[model samples]
Target: MKRIHDSLIVQTMSRLLIPLAQLFALYVLFFGQYGPGGGFVAGVIWTTSMILTFLVFGLKSPQGRLVEKVLHGDGVGLIIFVGVGGLCLIGGGEFLNYANLEIPGLDAPARRYMGILLGQIGVAVDVAVTGISIVLSLAYHDIEQEYHV
Candidate 1:
């Protein structure tokens, strides 16, 4: 099989398409509550873009360093997700009960919307980070085996 980086067409297309894919992922993430797409779809799309970038640029490249930078995002996202639920509990409701979220200015419906959106955002972030981490681990393993490290 032809290596992805060895194909000029593949490299050029991936460069051109990665940004567009990520943008679409954002759209899916934000509009998910009202539409067919959601955090998981968006996260998968984003991860696909990152994978394409890694294939084209190699893991040592600047773009690939993004994976390292975002490894901690997994925890942050989990915190956001759990924090939202904890807030609901503090508001005298069950975990993840958005209707019980007691923000100062927002009413019940608005609170629900905000809670769901924030949760989805958290899920997206966590999913993206986890997927990227898995790919990075695999790549590192391959490298290790290749050089017998």
Candidate 2:
């Protein structure tokens, strides 16, 4: 993609930014397990990374790359989210009860951990979609120029 603002400064900022965004997202997702975040946080985090990439790299090409990754990840995350429901049914315990199945080696508490993990994957998709859509719409307006109705 073309660099943003036609400036070396923007390019440099982006090169530094993308990874930090990802790391922060992961932190949010995992930290949610303890506080109030989870899959949604992860998804948002993914989106944020893409957005920063686009903001720094420029819209056309950068946006495409981000969208492509989001689409692919969204698909995989969605399948897993659905699959978790299937597991819930087989394991028995309402829709998402993971407690009924004997995981062979895992204890009861550990089963809960697994369930949370699965759920978070679903949440990640949600956050990512939000970020991607927001960035996409923003691309329509040229920040350096004014928009007219």
Candidate 3:
């Protein structure tokens, strides 16, 4: 693997920008319901940040561990999506019928909003995990080829 200090300026800049990029990704995720940015864009940003980390720090770095965690979490989004649908079905409504969720403390609109937010979160997690998994596999393959050659 290449040294972290391959270029002083590049190292410093990437280190600084990575966190900011991740923060912006989160911002895009939360504001997606109201604006243009959403799960897909947020997932792209997440993939970009992970790839940048791998490029800068190499495969053996902490970023690799993070990628592994992401892989493990890959199915979480799907589970959430299905779980929500199941809950609706159990509530005697059609699949994904947010209106059927009855929380005594909150009104129908609030329940619907919560359901939408959960669905969006599931999508975001699914997309981000898939993107990260692809990038990690490619990175691993490249490294394996490099070492074998």
Candidate 4:
């Protein structure tokens, strides 16, 4: 991570923005119980941070490699989706029904909320990686519109 003083606007913004994104993501995660902005928003926010991180850090390493990282995340997201769906498949009621399902240590409503968040997080990862992949793809094939012949 680049230090604050040496950071360019991109780096500075990336560092600042990731945390802010996470803050809001968690806010949406928790606050959704009473209000709106639950799992979906949180997932989007969570994934977006990765995109920003890639932009700032240039995506050189394993962790920053959106394509590779996203590959694994896709499976993760799928598993979460299916898990929630399975809960509904059983006598648990609707998909991710926290009220009826009885899993120890996790409250029914809380569990449902958590389930929503997990699903959203999976979506966010997919979105962010897709965004990064698009950027990379475009980098390979420049439109050259700005260049004068």
lDDT of each: 0.83, 0.68, 0.77, 0.59
lDDT of 3 by residue, 70-140 (tens): 77887898898778777878877889998776556877788787777777777878888888788767667
What are the models' TM-scores? 0.86, 0.74, 0.85, 0.60
Clashes of 3: 0
What TM-score would you give candidate 2 relative to the actual structure? 0.74
- Please identify model 2 stretches exceeding 4 Å from their true place: 1-3, 59-66, 72-75, 137-149
Local accuracy of candidate 1 as per-residue lDDT tens digits, 47-115: 888887877876556886675677767677789899999999999999999989989899999999999
Model 4 TM-score, all chains together: 0.60
Residue 26 of model 3, lDDT score: 91
lDDT of 4 by residue, 7-66 (tens): 587666666788898788778767765787765676667666765665456445444564
TM-score, candidate number 1: 0.86
lDDT of 2 by residue, 22-106 (tens): 8887887878768876788677767877776766655446454656456445366666776776776787666667664446788
Q: Can you list the residue pairs that collide in candidate 4? A: none
User: How many clashes (backbone atoms < 3 Å, residues ≥3 apart in a chain or on different chains) does model 1 have?
Assistant: 0
lDDT of 2 at 130: 56
The parts of candidate 4 lying over 4 Å away from their true place are 1-7, 61-63, 66-68, 91-98, 104-149
Candidate 4 all-Cα RMSD: 6.6
Best by lDDT: 1
The model with the greater TM-score, 3 or 4, is 3
Give the C-alpha miss distance for residue 6 in model 2, angstroms: 1.9
Rank all candidate structures by their TM-score, best first, as comma-separated numbers: 1, 3, 2, 4
